[model samples]
Target: MPELTMVQAVNHALRDEMRADDEVVVLGEDVGLNGGVFRCTADLFEEFGEDRVIDTPLSESGIIGAAIGMAMYGLRPVPEIQFSDFIWPAFDQITSELAKMRYRSAGQFTCPLVIRTPYGGGIRGGHYHSQSPEAYFTHTPGLVVVVPSDPYDAKGLLRSAIQSEDPVLFLEPKRIYRSPKMEVPDDDYTVEIGKAAVRREGTDFTITCYGAMVPVALEACKKAAEKGWEGEVLDLRTLLPLDTDALIDSVTKTGRMLVLQEAPKFCGYGSELCAIVAEKAIDVLEAPIKRVAGFDVPFPYTLEHVYMPHADRVLRGIEEMMDY
Candidate 1:
């Protein structure tokens, strides 16, 4: 077991999948020659060849549209949008075409595609380069949205995304792409989609978070422990088909909840969690299910530190919940 960065784990998933299945191909701007802006696809062009590792123009719509077409023709096309902010141009292709193809065609057609994009702030990517758009895809039917918190899950989940029959949105947190590494097993492994990973267990309270906020939540958990409080951290790897049972169990035991997310406050995935908690475990709650999230406004460049939910905000919410 050798530790590898998140980028390396993703690269291994793509390479292994392509080697195993001839239909697997990757296409995105600079994915061929430049190896992607973050070099997430470095050396893929040479190893997979230009045909399998194709590069396209700046049109996000065109890249996604073509991938949809390729999937319909029985190819597993993995496309990248460079950044999550730039994926809007392909909204119709993803929501209308890719999402509804199987249902609209009555199983006559299918789009087995993976759209990978780096999302969330932390690298000072500003509004254009940094934004969490998973909630958008989660709202659309027939799309699988996934976000991995670490390299091991990154590799396993990407492999699962590539092999799934339905279209998948693979959201990677670019900020941790190279900073975090783990000794992922050498053998083949595929983390099941729609599962939540419990990073730490405690009975005092449950702090459920995802993506870029996971490490922050972990830090908050450590702080809570030092102050004589116990908290559990749930890493929601899959946005859709969330592990409701795990969520319910943790909250039922702790009798308190705080949902953490990097996305904006309004209409965020956090809202859905709030509803689910209230519905399933209202009686078990000692306090309202609080949420710490980014402000509703567009991600601000200069004030991003305050815009995105921080560890302090999370702890404050937790402390309030405990007092209640």
Candidate 2:
């Protein structure tokens, strides 16, 4: 086992996929030689050659649009958006063309591509580079959204995302790219997407989160345990086909839930989880389902700490729910 950062883990996945499948290709800004702005693709071009690891022009729309054509021709194209903030320009290609191509073709065509981008705050990227856009793609049918918390999940889920039959929007937490480190398995293993993991299990209360927010929730739980509160923390590794059963079960067991996230509160993934908890496990709740999320305003220039959901905020939600 080797302790790898989020960036290194993702790099491993892409390298493994490209080696395993000749049809696999990666295209994005500086992906060929510079290894991406974050170096997630560092050295991929040198190994796989320029034809496979392409350095595309600075055009998100063109990258995604061209990827769709490649997939239609039976190639698995992985396109990278330097930042989630820049993906809006290619939103049409994703939501309209790539997403519908598979269904519209009715078994005639499949656009099995992965749009990988880094998201979330804690890097002082202000509004643009710090945003979490998973909710946007999750809203659009036919697109799968994945947000992995740690190094292990990063490598595994990216492998699964690349091989997934549907077009996947893979969001890596930029903040955790270099911060958190964990032992990744030596051999190849892809974590099945759309499954939520119970990071810390307890019956007191459940705090559910994904991506970098998982660490916050776990830290809050650790603190709560010292004060005699055993909090259950669930990491929703895959945001799209959410493991609603695990969520409902955890909430039902604890009879309390506080959905924590880095994304803004308005119509975010937390909203969907909250609604699901209400609909499926309302009778099991001891109190109203609570949320600890970023403020609905744009990410601040200097108040990044205040804007993001922190350990205190998560603990506060726990206190509120347990008190109620």
Candidate 3:
């Protein structure tokens, strides 16, 4: 095993997948020649050639539409939407067509594709590049939303997503893309989707989060520990088809819950998580569930730190839950 950054792990996964399956093709703006905006697909153009590693026009809808067509024709297409904020142009293709192909065709057709996009605040990408839009896709009926926190899971989950016989929305947090290297296996492996990983074990309370917010939640737990409260940290790597069983188990033991997210609070993913706990495991909770999330307003340029949920906000939410 070797330590690799999230971006490096992503590149490794693409290379490995391309080698293993001829059906796997990479397509998106600057993904081929330019190696993607973040270099997640670097050197792939030379290795796989122009036919396999395609560089598409500057149309998000066209990119997704072409990918959907390719998938229908039995090719595994991994299309990268340069930024999650710019993905709206292809929303109809994703929600209406890509997500509904299997159900609409009564299992006669399946969209074996992955839409990779950089998401979340931090790194000062402002509103145009840093929006967290996983909730919208997660609400769709047939889509699988996955957000990996570290490099290890980033590679494994991506491999799993590409291999699955369904459309997967793979949201990569741009904040820590090049930071925090983690040991990842060089062999073939896949992280099971729809499973929540308990990063840290504790009994005082449980902090559930995913993507960039996972690190913030862990930091909040560390802060809590310093104040004599050991908070368990649960990373919902797979957002849609959430691992509620894992969530309930941890909340049941901790008797308190704090859900965190970089997305806005109103009708956000954290609210859905909190609602699930309130419905299924409310009896086991010692206090009301708390949710720490970005404000409802649009992501601001100058107030990046204020807009995104941080360790201090999560710690405050945890303390509020405990005191309640």
Candidate 4:
């Protein structure tokens, strides 16, 4: 076992997959020589050389279009989109072409590809750079959307994504890229997609979240413990194909639920979680499902602290749910 950050774990997964399978290729801007903008692909170019690691022009649509072609031809391509905020430029290619490959072809063709992109706010990235557009893709059919909150899951989920036959959107939370180092196994392992992990267990309430908000929820649970409110933190690592069983179980046990996300609250991912609980576990609910999320506004550059959900804000939401 070795201690690694999320970024290092991502690089390790890419290296391991590329070594195990020659078909696994990495292509994106600065991913070859520059080691990627976040260094997630550091040193891969020197080892694999040009054919396996390619640097492309600054075009999201072109990058994705080429990767789709490679995938359809039997090569497992992992294309980097730099940031989730820039993914819209290639939305048509992803949602229309990439997503519809298997269905449109009636099982005759499948696109085995992973689109890697850093997402969410926490590094002062303004409106252009800091946006959580996960809801858009999660709503789409035939695509797997994954978000890892720690290095351990980051390595495993990425490996699983590369091995998946279906196209995957791997969203890496840029905030915890380097922090929260953990001991990750050097051997091959994988965290199954579409499963949620219970980061903390409690009996009073459940705090459901994913990606960067997982840590924030955990912190709020810690603070709530001091106030005699035992909180459970459920990390929904995979947004699409959500682990509905785990979600319903947690809410049923605690009898209260709080959904959190860095995205805007208006029609955000949290809304779906709330709806799921309301639809399936309404009878067991003791109180209204509370939500603490980013404001329904553009990601601000200056007031990020206020716009984004924090531990204090989450604690308040917990208190309200508990009191109700």
Q: Pick by lDDT: which candidate is best?
A: 4
Better of 1 and 3 by lDDT: 3
Candidate 1 stretches greater than 4 Å from native: none
lDDT of 1: 0.91
Estimate, for each residue in 130-209, the C-alpha lDDT of model 4 and write its tens digit: 89999999989999999999999999999999999999999999999999899999999999998999999999999999
What's the lDDT for residue 16 in model 2?
Answer: 94
On residues 1-324, what C-alpha lDDT tens digit does candidate 3 reach at each position?
799999999999999999999999999999998999999999999999999999999999999999999999999999999999999999999999999999999998889999999999998988799899998999999999999999999999999999999899999999989999999999999999999999999999998888888889888889999999999999999988889899999999999988888898899988888888889888998888888889999899998988889899888988898788
Show pairs that collide, candidate 1.
Answer: none
Q: What is the C-alpha local distance difference test score of each model?
A: 0.91, 0.91, 0.93, 0.95
Could you tell me how far off, in angstroms, the CA of residue 100 lies in candidate 3 after the best superposition? 0.6
Query: What lDDT is obtained when candidate 4 is compared to the true structure?
Result: 0.95
Model 4: worst 10 consecutive residues (lDDT sum)? 128-137
Q: lDDT tens string, model 2, 181-202?
A: 8999868899999899999999
lDDT for model 3, on a 0 to 1 scale?
0.93
Which is the better candidate, 1 or 3, if ranked by TM-score?
3
RMSD of 3: 0.8
| Candidate 3 minimal-lDDT segment of 10 residues | 315-324
lDDT of 4 at 251: 95
Error of 2 at 251 (Å): 0.9
